[model samples]
Target: MKTFTVEEVAQHNKADDIWIIVDGKVFDVTKFLSEHPGGKKVLVKMAGKDATKKFKQFHNDAIMQRVGLPMQIGVIGAEKKEEAPKPVAAAAAAAAAPLTPGKLVSADEARFGDGFPYGDPNWYQDWNSPYYNESHMRLRKVIREFAEKELMPYCHEWSEAKAIPREVVKKVAQAGFLNAASGAGTNPSVASLLPYPLPAGIKHEEFDIFHEFICVDELARCGSGGLLWALQGGLSIALPPVMNFAPEPIKKKVVPECLAGEKFIALAITEPSAGSDVAGLKTSAEDKGDHFLLNGEKKWITQGAYADYYVVAARTGGAGMGGVSLLLVERAWEGVEARYMDVMGMWGSGTSYITFDDVKVPKTHLIGKLNEGFKYIMHNFNHERLGIVMQANRLARVCIEEAFTYSMKRKTFGVRLIDHPVIRNKLGHMIRQCEATHAWLENIMYQIKTLPEASQPARLGGPVALLKAQSTQTFEFCAREAAQIFGGLAYTRGGQGEKVERLYREVRAYAIPGGSEEIMLDLGIRQATKNFEKRSKI
Candidate 1:
C-alpha cells in the first residue's frame, strides 16, 4: 500500500471525498456513512480527521477487524517511526531472555495444564494429586484437543442453529466419548456398543467416574451450556437408569442403539406444575394389563425433540412417593407429542415440552419394580448432582480464564486492566471460589469411588447436593464478575466476550436444573442430618 502524508491527505475534507485515520491506517468510510449502525451524521462529523479515539470508544477490535480493515487506503507516514535505540546492557539482557509471546510448551515438557493459574484442577498442572494418573492426563489431552479443534470453534454457530447437528453427535459417539459419558465403557455388555476404541491410550475397563468427570469438565471448556447438553446431557442422565434397573431385553435393545448414536433418550421427570417436588408430579399412568396407558405432559425435557425414547415418571398408585413408577416411553408410540421449548438458555439441547396421550408403554419397559420408582429417582439424583457440580465448576473456571485473558490484553487508564487493584480483587474472589469448589468436587468423587454402589445414595447424596449448589453459585458470581471485567464486550454476542455473554445467559439453566439452589441447600442439610443420625448411637 502507498503511504500518505498528513498534508497530502488534508485536501479531501468534504463529505463527497472524506478520509479518516484510525490506528495509523487511513480509511475511506464515505460510502459506509449510510450503512454504519450509528447514523451518517456521526461519521460525517469525524470525516477527514484522525478518528482513532472516537472509533475505539464506540467499537471493539472485532468491528474494526471486520469493517475498518476493508476500507483501509494507506498507512499515515507520521506513524511509521523507526524502533528507538536500546542501551547496550539492556540489549544483552533482552537477547538472553525468552522470546516475546513465548514458545509453545508441549504437554510432555511440563504438563503445565494450559499455564493459567486455577484454569484447571490444581492436579492438572503437576500439583500433587491422588486421583489423576497418566491415563487421566491422556484422556484430558484427548478431550481438550477434540473440544478446541472441533466443538469450540463452531459452538456459537451451533447454538444459533438451535440444535446440535446429528453428524457432530455421531462423531462424538464414534470417538467412544459417549460410551464413557453414559457409564457404558465400564459395562462390558454396553461397552461393545461403542463404534470405536477408546481414544488411543484410554482403556474401557479402567474408565471410572473420575474419567467421566474429566470428560464433562473438558467438554464444558467449550463454554456453551447449550452445546455440551445438546451432545450428552440427556444421555448421561436418561441412559443410566436403563442400564441399572431396566429388564435385560429392554436394556439390550435400547442401550446399544442410544450408545451407538443411532438413537437418543431423555429423562422426563420435571413437569410444568412440579419441579424439585417429585412426589407432587401429577402425570398419570393407568394399568391396562399388558401395557400401561401413559397420559401426561413433561416440560423442560432436554433433548426431548430428538429423543427416540423417554424414561418418564408417572403416578401409578394412590398418592405421594409410593404411587410413582418409571416407564420407558418410546417416541414412536401413538399419541406421543414433543415440541421444542424456547428456554432462557441451552437452546441447542432441544429442550422440549412433551405430551403423552393414552400412550401404551409395555409392562416390560418398567424400570425396576412397579411403584418403586421413587427409590430409583433418589439413586439417580446423586449422579445427576455430581454431573451438575462438574459442569458448573468448569464453567466457573471458564469465566476466570476469559476475564483473566481479557484483563491481560485490554488496557484502561494507560495500563492493562489486570494492573487495577479492584479488577484483581474481583479475580481473587472468583479464583478462590473456583479452587475451593474444585477441591470439594474432587473429594466427593473420591468418596463416590470408594463407597459401594448400593450405599452411595445414602452416604454421598447430601455432600454432592451441597457441592452442586456451591458450584452453581460460584458460576453465577464468576459470570457476573467476568461481565464487569469485559464491560460492553461481554454484553454483546459473537465477539471477544462471546463465551462470557453466552455463559452469563446460561447461569440460571445450571442453577435451576438438576436441582434448584434453594432446594439443594435444604435437601443437603436434611439428608446429611438423617445420615448422621443413622450412623450415630446418640
Candidate 2:
C-alpha cells in the first residue's frame, strides 16, 4: 500500500486529507468519507494511511461484489488544468472554408503545442479545406444558435427521457433547413445554394456550395442525435429521384411538403430476407392499371412511423438487379402500415417496420422508369452512405470532446488522469481516428460538390462507399473506447446521457444501415475497378 506524506498533501491544498492506495491504486479520500461505497467507518479507519490491507480484508471478493465494480471506487486529487487556447472570433476565420467548402476542420489547433495540430493526427493540415464559404459561416451561426439556445437546455433532460417535443421539430422545419440543399422559400440572397439540393451542376456555385454539408454538421451538434437523424434523413429522402426523375406534379406534391416539414419520406431498400443484397428482395409491386400494388415489408426504415411517403424499393421485373424499382408510397393510401420499432439509439427518430399490403400508389408517383429503380436506389446509396459517414464523424467528435473533458476532471494516483501518458494515449488514438474520418469525409464532400448532380454519386461512389464503411466502424470503435475511459460513469445514466452509451447503440445501426461494411467494401472495390477501367478506356 502506498501512502502520501503530510508535507506532500499540504503542499497541494490538502489539509485534513486521507489518502488510500487500494489494489495498488492510490486515491485521495478527502471527499470519499460519505461517498465511499465501503461505508465511512471502514474508510475512516485508514483515512490518512494506505487502505490496501484493510481493503483486502474488507473485500475478499464477497465484499468486492457488494461494492460494485473496481471503477466505482472514485479517485480524488489535485489537477493541473491545461489552459484552453482562445478560439479565434474573426468573422473571416469563422466563415472561411476550413476545408473544401463543405468540410469540417478539427478544433484541436496545436498552436499551444506540437500534438494538438487541428483535428488529431496532423494529417489534414495540408489538405485543402474549403468549408469556409459564406453560407457555411451563416449556417454555423444558425446551428450554434439552435444548439445553445434552442436545443442545449433541454437536450440532456430530453435525451435521458428519450423524448423530444414535436414543437422543436416544427421550429426546425420552419427554419428551412430540412430542405437546405434545395431552394424552397429560402431567401435566395441569403441561401442561394438552396435550389440545388445535391450540388449538381452550376460549376462555381456547386464547387463553392459548402452550406449544404454545414446544415447536417451543425444540426448533429445540436445534442439530440435522434432529431438530427430524422431531419437529415428527411432531406436525403427528398434529394434523390425527385431531383432527377420525378414529374412536375409528383415532384411539386412530394418535394415541397418535405421542405415545409409537414410530410416525411424514407428510402426503403433493405428487406429482412435480403438485407444488403437489394437484388435479392422478395417484395414486389405489380402493375394494376392506374396504380401499382406494392406488397412488401421493409425493415429498419428510418422515420418509418410518421413518413408521409416512402421512397420505396421493390422488384418489378424478372430476377436479379434488373428487376428492381423505386416507387413512392404515401401513408395516406390504404394498405400501408407502419409499426414503431424500439431501436438501440435515436429513440425519437421514429424508425419502424413498414408493410405495404397491396398498397395502391398512383402511377404518377412512380420514381423514374418502371425497371429503373435499381439505378435510382444504387445511385441514392452513395448519398445515404455519405450521410451515415457524417453521423460517424459527429459521433467521434462527441466522444473526443467528452473524453477530453472527463480526463481533465477524473483523477488518479494523486494527479489528473489526462496527465498520465497511458490516459493521453487514449485521447491520442481517438484523435488520430477522428482526423482520418474527417479527412476522408471532406475529400468525398469536395468530389460530391463538383460533379454534375446527374452523376455525382456514380463518379464518387467508390470513395464514398469505402469511407462510409470505415467511418461507421470508426464511430463504433471510438464509442467503445470512450465508454472504457469513462468506466463507471458511462454505465450509470440518470442525467445527461453518456455519448458512448448513445453512440454504442447508434453506431451499430450505421454498420447495418445504408449497406453493411462488407457489402460496401465489395461494391466499392468493384466500382473503383470499373472507374479505373473506364478512365483507361477514355
Candidate 3:
C-alpha cells in the first residue's frame, strides 16, 4: 500500500531487482522474469517502467488478478476510493414510484462489477425490474462475492485436474448452496424439504424462482462448464427424483447426506445404446422376493464415478417406456462398478461409465410405482432443461464480456479492435442474442413461478424445450464469434482468451445434453401443433 513515484520505481531497473507499474500498481517482477510465459526478454524490456498498455495487449484481467497481483509491491500514487453503490432500499423506493409519460424511472440500483455496458443484466446496471426486489439484490451480491472469492480463481485448475477438491465441495454445502441447487425454483414444496437454511439469510417464505435464478446466473459467471458441472451438474438433476419420489425411508437416509455434501448422487438413464430414446435403454431389473436384481450399463453419467448413490432407470417388465422403473441403487452394493470416461469437455464433471452386474437393490428402494418411471423422468425435464438454458445463456454473456474487454484493449491495424465496424457488428449480434435469450429465460421463469403446480408440465414443457434449443444455439454462436475476435488467443488454452477457448469447446455439451437441437426443435413444434389443433374448431 506504500506509494512510490515513477522515478523511484525506475531506480530498480536492473534484471536482478526489476519493478514495473501496471494500471498504476507496482509489481516486482524480478523473480517472475524466468516464469513469464513470453520469456524473460519481454519482462527485461518493460522493467522499471509503466507496462499497463503493453500488458493489456497480450493478457486480460484474469491474468492480472491470478498472476500479477501476487507480485504487486505497492501503488504509484494516492489510491482512488471506489464510490459505494446505492442502497437496495433506495432502489426499491425508486422502483415503486409512479411512472409518467415523459419521465424515466431511474431506480439506479448499485451496479455490479465493472460497468462494461451489457456485461451483466440490465438490472445489475441500475435498471428497475418488476421481477427483482431487495432480497434478490442482496442474494445477488452475496452469491457473486462467493463465486469470485471461492470458485472463480480455481476454475481452470480444477478443470484441468479433472476433479474438484473435496474440501471445496464441503465448503459449498456448508454455505447452503447444495440445498439451493437441488431445490427446483418451480416447486414451492421444495422449500419445506431443504435440510439447510438458505444462504444470504433469505427467509424460506420469501424465497422464489428468481432467487434460484440468481444462484444459477452467478455460478455460471465463473465461465467454466467443467467447474460448474463438477459443482452441481449431477446433484441438481439426480437428487430431485429422490427428493420427490423415493420412499420416505430412502429419502430420510439419502436426501440429508447428499444435500449436506457428505455424499454424491447421479441420475443414470442414458445407456451406450440410448441417449434421448429413453425407452430403448437396456438396463434391466428383475423382481425377487425382497430385492430386485439390477444388471446393465449407463454411459456418460455425470459425476457417476464419485456418486455414492444413483437414481437408476431400468426395465422392470415388458418393453418400451411402460416397462421402465426408477430405483435407488447404492454405489457400495455388490457388483456395482464405475469408471471415469475421457470426454471432449466437462473434464471436471467426472463423467463415467457405470455397470451393475446383478446388484441386489432392496424392493423398498424403488422410486414411485413400477412402470411409472417414464412419467417421473418426463416430469423432471422442464426443470432440468431450464437449468441448462440458464447456464448456456449466462455462458454466452461471459463470451461477450471477455471479448468486449479484449477488444477495447487489443489493437489491430494500429487501432483498438472496438474501433472497427466489423468487430462492432459481431458484438452487436452477440449482445442482442444474449440479451434476448436472457429476457426469454426471465419470462419463462415468470410462467414457472405463476402457473398452478399441477398444470405446469403440460403448459410449459414445449416452451422450455424451445428455449433450451435457443439458448444452446446462442451460446454456440457467441463462443464462435468471441473466438474470432480473440483470434490466436482464443485458440490457446490460457491467457487473454482462455474463457473463449474453453467455452468454444463446451458448446456441444450444452447443445447435445438435456436434449439435442434436432429433438428439442421437433418436440417443441409437435407440442405446439397439438395445442393449436386442440384450440381450433377446424
How many backbone clashes can be found in candidate 2? Answer: 16
Best by TM-score: 3
Ranking by lDDT: 3, 1, 2
> Each model's TM-score?
0.81, 0.73, 0.94
Q: Which residue runs of candidate 1 sit more than 4 Å off their true CA positions?
A: 1-108
lDDT of 2 by residue, 368-486 (tens): 89888888777666766777777677777777766676676667789987898987888888878877888778777777656677777667887887888888777777777788777
Off by over 4 Å in 3: 79-110, 184-195
Tens digits of lDDT, candidate 3, 145-259: 7888888877777777888998898787777777666664334545555667787777877778888888888889989988878778877788788878888888878877877
Candidate 2: minimum summed lDDT over ten consecutive residues — where? 110-119
Error of 3 at 16 (Å): 1.8
What's the lDDT for all of these models? Answer: 0.83, 0.64, 0.85
Candidate 1: what lDDT? 0.83
What are the per-residue Cα lDDT tens digits for candidate 1 across 1-538?
A: 7799776667667777878888888888878877887788887787778888787655545456556788999988844667885543343233322222343333343343567767777656544566765567667767887877667777777877888889898888877788777767655666655666765357778887788888889889989999878888888889888888999899889887887788999999999999989999999999999999999899999999889999999999979999999999999999999999888888789899999999988898899999999888887788788888888899999999988988887889999999999999999999999999998988988887788878888778788888999999999999999999999989987767888899999999999988899999998899888878888944
Q: Please give the TM-score that candidate 3 achieves against the real structure.
A: 0.94
